[model samples]
Target: MLVDIRVQEEGFSLDAELARLAGVGLDVGGIGLFMGLVRGDGGLAALVLEHYPGMTESMIARIVAQAGTRFGLLACTVIHRVGRLPVGAPIVLVLCAAAHRGAALEATEFVIDWLKTQAPFWKREEFPDGQGRWVAARESDEAAAARWGMDGPTES
Candidate 1:
């Protein structure tokens, strides 16, 4: 299995990333992708993301490993951006490839759900009124992560 993980401040090109995955060879029959973007609601100006350097990478690596093992993924890539990002900018991307659609789709969903709750990242939203507030974990997200029934991040 091919696993690629990166956390960076620069914006990524989805086309380039997908092309890299295609280089992995011909056994891959399905590719599942998800992209998360900053919302423009509530007069938002930008979204700031912070993370512990080594710890964040380690945690996400663990999550990706678990997904690969569980779903028998052929290839996977996870990219998450940090620093201040303007509204509508992409924040996270997860792409999984497998021999069949089921495994690829399931692994993609599992990794993303776990990443949302397990990844050690702090988020703050800046408003146009010169106000900023730390984003709180939503109950909905916790619930979504819980459906996987894995031993990683989930609602208490």
Candidate 2:
């Protein structure tokens, strides 16, 4: 089981990554993969993902590790983008492998939900209307983070 945590700096290929994530386990019953793309809202031009370097990685590692503890998943990968990224760039990815479909699916969901709030990442939207602002963390994210029973990150 291999877990990759990378910063998507340039163009990335999802298919290629999915291919690489495959591992030994001829009886692999299920694999789950998720890709998040940029969005445009209210004339938003582009977006930037900023995080507290060491803390961000530690949080992610903890989340992935917790998924392992909870579900005994085979493997998982989480890749997040940083710096100036266009609206359509892949911000994050999570791939989970398991002996059965259920664990894989649950772990995938858990990783994404945990990432939204616990990861310490912030997004700034550059509006085409000559304005820029940070997207407030979603209430859903707060709700999801509560499931883990951990104090959320401090807003910047």
The 0-to-1 C-alpha lDDT of every candidate, in the order given, reads 0.90, 0.77
List residue ranges in candidate 1 displaced over 4 A: 153-156
**Count of backbone clashes for each model?**
0, 1
Least accurate 10 contiguous residues by lDDT in model 2: 147-156
List model 1 lDDT by residue over 15-117, tens digit each: 9988888778898888899999999998899999999899788888888888888898888999999999999999999999888899999999999998988
- Could you list the CA RMSD of all candidates, in the order they appear? 2.1, 3.2
Name the regions of candidate 2 deviating beyond 4 angstroms: 147-156
Per-model TM-score versus the true fold: 0.95, 0.87
Candidate 1 residue-wise lDDT at 73: 88
What value of lDDT does candidate 1 attain over all alpha carbons?
0.90
Cα error, candidate 1, residue 149 (Å): 1.0
- lDDT, model 1, position 119: 87
